[model samples]
Target: MILVTGGAGYIGTHVVRSLIRHGMDVVVYDRRPLPQPLLDGKPFLPVPFVVADLADRQALDETFEKYEFEAVIHLAGDIVVSESVAEPEKYYLNNVGGGMSLLAAMRRYGVMKIVFSSTAALFGLPERVPILEDDPVRPINPYGRTKWMFEQMLDDYDRAYGLKFVSLRYFNASGADSSGLIGEAHDPETHLIPLVLEVPLQKRPYVSIFGTDYDTPDGTAIRDYIHVSDLAEAHVLAVKYLRDASESRCYNLGNGRGHSVREVIATAEEVVGASIRTVETPRRPGDAERLIAGNERIINELSWKPNYNDLNVIVESAWRWHKGQN
Candidate 1:
């Protein structure tokens, strides 16, 4: 059986669905309450869901004791870049220390394989356009720093014991599951596509165009946005690869295309059938001007191909999911 941490959250929920689709027996563990939508009237295909904080050593031990988890896909942690800057302690404690706690528990239980949900934020200000796994990691925010620290810890663990891992450094995950059953649902959504879509629904007055003087063609910051479904597929592949391979590895997951702030807003407006108003603002700290992933490694190694790489396609899936809430 496989265990998923943070399975109630956006990406984790999608991963759980993918795993279930593949006929895999899975258990979800999260700190927050199991989202009602995930368990709504689904008694026949009952996927075991548990709410337990990873940092709590007793809870972690109990989780291992209850389930025979052969593999783990960790997706738990604080993920806001701006918040990480303001509150570094929370990121370090939750991302780093909490990850260590999970690792310790997994070690104790002899669960050797893991597919870590790492972020591209570890590549703070890239020296090149498309970043690779071998690129220098100099994270400017605590969130990225914490993830990098965990990657280092994993390396150490692999050397000490025989722990196989695949750290998939995701770049700007957006959009929703094609089934529309689950989507991005952060309480105070900080993602670009979701925030832009909210403007049409009056959830937010206007989207902020942060830093409109970058060196890009649109003079605004550019980011690679990959669909959540594609990311879920990558996680499944990582799990399969880890089981076959014997060593730890890392891969960058992205669309290989960058969309500027103006372009994204324009696409959202086009997809939602409305004009999106925006407010010009200064650059947010710790945000890079252009961040796109060099997805060649995963594509070449794991044959990972993103199904929805277009901005309009990504925004449309998000729009549908958001509108479904009403």
Candidate 2:
């Protein structure tokens, strides 16, 4: 059985469904209880859920004791990059400190395999386009620093104990399930595709484009936006890789294609059949210029491939889900 911390979250929901579709037993542990609206009639409904923060040692111990977990997909962490800068203590205490609590419990219960949800922010400003897994990491924000710090802990744990891990550095996780049963639904959605979709949904006045003077063709930052389902599939493959007793590894998951902010808005406009307004703004701290992914490593190793790599297709999926929400 697999234990998914934060399994009720945006990405966590998809990952849990993927694990179920792959014929693995899953139990979710999150700081918040599972939202009933998310699973009232979904195909992968009724997954065992444990509601508690990762820092709660009692909750972790009880969960570890109850479930005979083979591996863990650790996704329960503070994710807002901008918020992390203003209140770094929250990021450290939750992302880093919470992770320590989870790791200690995993060690105690002999569940040493974990698939960590990492981010591309660790590569603050890459020296080249299509960043590689081995690229230098100099995180400029507290959130990225927290992820980097947690990854360092994984490496140290691997050396000290017999813990094996697969850290997946996702570029930009967007889109939703075609069924519209689940999708990206962050409280204050910070992702570009969803934020742009909001203009059409009448939720926001205009899409804010940060970093308009970038070196990219569109003069806006370019990011590799891999579909959410594609990212979910990688987690299943990573757990399988570790299950095979393979060595600890880290891989970058992306579409291998870069889309500028203008391209994203254009795609959303076409998908929603409505012209979305936009405003140019300064770059947010810790944002990279061009963050296309060189995902050959995961491709060759896990035989992982992205089914929805096109910008139009990616935005269309999100449009379907968001339209359903309204």
Per-residue lDDT of 301 in model 1: 89
Positional deviation of residue 26's Cα in model 1 after best superposition, in angstroms: 1.0
| Candidate 2 per-residue lDDT over residues 1-326, each given as its tens digit | 99999998999988987898898899999978765554445544458899999989998999999989999999998888889888999999999999999999999999999999999888988898688999899899999999999999999999999799999999899988777778888876888888999888999999888888887787998889999999999999999999876589989989888988999998888888889999888987667788988899999999998998888988999988899889
TM-score of each: 0.96, 0.97
lDDT of 1 by residue, 1-326 (tens): 88999998999888887887778888989988655554456642258887888888998888899989879999998998778888999989999999999999998989999989998998999999899899999988788899999999989988989888999999989998876667898866888888888888898899998888889998899999999988998988888888778778899989989989999998888898999889999887667888999999999989898888878888889998899875
Task: Please report, as a residue range, the 10-residue window in candidate 1 with the lowest summed lDDT.
Answer: 36-45
Model 1 pairs whose backbones collide: none
State each model's C-alpha RMSD to the native.
1.7, 1.5
User: What's the distance in Å from true for residue 30, model 2?
Assistant: 0.7
lDDT of 2: 0.90
Model 2: weakest 10-residue lDDT segment is: 36-45
In model 2, what lDDT does residue 174 have? 93
Clashing pairs in 2: none
